[model samples]
Target: MKWIPQEVETYLSAKEYVDTAVIPVYSLSFGEEMKQSAAAFEFISLLTGYLEKQFTGRILLFPPYTYLKSEHIENVVSGLSKWEETVVQNEFKHIFYITSELDLRMFENKVDGSLIWLPSLPLGNMNEPQKIEVVESQAKQLLSIFTQKWSNHE
Candidate 1:
């Protein structure tokens, strides 16, 4: 399920079955560096779409959390950690923060949930086949991590 109206309703109706929240983090830059910023969002947007579709029932894909590229990352990390605390109290035992922004790893230990980082990919120019290839590769890694997490929790 995603952050859409109907899905959110469904999620609310059955919160127990949907114990995982998949949040995507992106960075926005102003001016000359805007191109890279856009690409970063597009990359995670594509990847998140794929993951959400495959694991809709067990996962809720939240809206992208975008921060200014120039802002201090520690502050962002602190904010995100606080947000995770709220979600944790809501019964989401497994919170997965997935992103293409490598800088986010700085506070991975501080966050109360698992963080999955995939190398940034340029999704703007890719053809259909190329996009599928890239998403599949990244999804393979995610599947492994999720499998391990679920099995261990059980």
Candidate 2:
């Protein structure tokens, strides 16, 4: 499931089964690191989309949580904490924050949700088939992580 209206309707009717939320964190930049930031966005967007399709009714793929690369880490964490509060209040049992920004790892424990840090894979040059293959492979690896968390909670 996704955040779109149609999916929201489906999710509303089956909220009990859709207990997980996946948020992709993006670091936007406009300077020398612009290209790197774009690459991270592309990789994470694709990966999360693939993951959502694999578990459509079980997970809701929220929009990307984007922050400027130059922003303070503390501020970033603070903002995400607010999101967590809202998500929990809305009955999501599990929340996963996926990102390629390594710096976020240092503050993972500060957030209630699981924080996943995946190094950005440059997909700008890959052909469509190659992109799908790479994204699928990464999504496959994430499947176990999500399932394990779900099992533990249950």
Candidate 3:
């Protein structure tokens, strides 16, 4: 389920079964690093969308948790901590934070949720079909990770 109103309504109706929340973390930047930032955004957005579709009834795909690339890592972690508290309070059993920013991995243990750091795959040159194929491939790889987390909780 996505963050859109219609999907959210569906989620509200069957909240019990939606035990996982996936939040994509994006590091935005302007000037010299703009292209890199955009690539990461596009790649992660597509990847998470694919994941949501595959696990539709079981996961809620939240909007990307975006921050400037120049921001301090401690601040970013602090912000994510707040999000973690809210999601946990709302009864989500699993929280997965997906990001292309490698620095986030260093602070993964500081946050309660699982942090999945995927190196950004440049998708700017790929055609639509190729983009889908790549995203699907990456999402397929993620299936086992998510299922493993679910099994552990169960």
Candidate 4:
């Protein structure tokens, strides 16, 4: 797909309206091995480039996060090694992302104050209350330091 900012701007300009930009969160693992897979960060440089050109002072492109994964620790580690700094330094008004159950602990050391984390809801037999509880626990841990807004979605 084309850079998200360009796509969003085209739609907005044609409609002549202003709206909050909500970039869909992607699994951060794709960043480390983009040579091996297609993911959001590969185009992040493109996004940043477009932001500089189109909305220099007005737009923010939220970075994606490592989402629900049961066995991709290696992938996550590689992604963090490769893209964490760039993502952290992105010139945007906000940094929004998703967080899965597996990496919650590791996130403590990696999180930056500007990032918004969307909690992952487990699939299958997990009930609504149970899911809420799961995210609540994670939220408490996050709230210990950061005060950014967080929303949970399945």
Candidate 5:
């Protein structure tokens, strides 16, 4: 569920079952390739929304954590690791960090939660169907991973 008032209220009452937290980490692109950055952000939102819909009752969708693309990987990973602390303290047993930025993989092992790296999809001129197709496919892959995690925990 998104971090809105209605969701938060529901989350508070049902926090027992909401054991997972999904966070999208977006890296800001500077310079001439700004269009790609925008596209990436849009795509992440679409993918995130899809994930939330499927796991609304079990997962909490925190706002995207944005960082500069050029930031030091060490610092980025360290900061993000801390993000998991709050979630864990709040009773979330599983935390999934999703991102479309390929560069972040370097620090994946250093982060506190599982990091899902998605290939960047440019939605510049895609038709509605194409966009839906892309999002659906990616969401399926994500769900598969999440399902595995759940089963393993069980």
Candidate 6:
């Protein structure tokens, strides 16, 4: 059997139904005479659906790229809030989140010890384990910075 995380395992084995969000991104604009390419849109839909099935409907948040307008970028500060509302309505404990620092403020927040940052890569072509080790070490050092603040409140 595979060693799945507690949350992921529970989500996968759950008897109740779950809700999911299908979101995607693009590398170009739609109105600049470069009409939204069918290829991009199809790729997004396919990946989002695949991820949703794999996570068993625990994922709710998605970057607004498939259909995001210019105004949506300004609303990112409240992005988590919107996700929480969706989670509440759906009553799910597992949320599979996928995004980048460009959207998640990766350098700004302290990650929970349970989390990991995975850079985009072709794992089969490189030393993926070593890369993960390096990233994990950095995560530990970064997380330590906030530990002091948290300890003081105890």
For all predicted structures, in order, the TM-scores are 0.94, 0.98, 0.98, 0.33, 0.95, 0.37
28: Cα error in model 2, Å: 0.7
Model 4, which residues run further than 4 Å from truth?
Answer: 1-78, 113-154
Across 52-147, the per-residue lDDT of candidate 3 in tens digits comes to 989999999999999998999999999999999999999999999999999899999999898999999999999999999999888888999999
Query: How well is each residue in 9-118 modelled by candidate 6, as lDDT tens digits?
Result: 65556526433333344334356523434433433333344444444443432454332435354354355445545654655433333332244344224321112222
TM-score of 3: 0.98
Q: Could you tell me the lDDT of residue 28 within candidate 2?
A: 93
Model 1: number of backbone collisions: 1
Return the clash pairs for model 5, or none.
Answer: none
Candidate 5: which stretches are off by over 4 Å? Answer: none
Question: lDDT: which is higher, 3 or 5?
Answer: 3
- Model 1 clash pairs? 1-56
Ranked candidates (TM-score, high to low) = 2, 3, 5, 1, 6, 4
Give every collision pair in model 6.
none
What lDDT score is found at residue 30 in candidate 1? Answer: 77
Q: Write the per-residue lDDT of candidate 4 for residues 1-154, one digit (tens) a residue.
A: 1246876566445432322222333444345544322323333333333333443323343444444344475565555434545644442223333333334445535644233334343323566566445545654554432323322210
| Predicted structure 4: lDDT | 0.40
- Residue 62 miss distance in model 3 (angstroms): 0.5
Model 4 residue 144 lDDT? 37
Candidate 5 lDDT (Cα, 0 to 1): 0.88
Candidate 5: give its CA RMSD in angstroms: 1.0
- Clashing pairs for predicted structure model 4, backbone only: none
Evaluated at residue 149, the lDDT of candidate 1 is 92
Q: Residues 1-154, candidate 1, lDDT per residue (tens digit)?
A: 9999999999999999998889999888879978888887877888888888988899999988778878899988988888898889999989888887778887799897898887788877999899888988888789889879988897
- By TM-score, the better pick of 3 and 4 is 3
Distance from true location, Cα of 132 in model 2, Å? 0.9
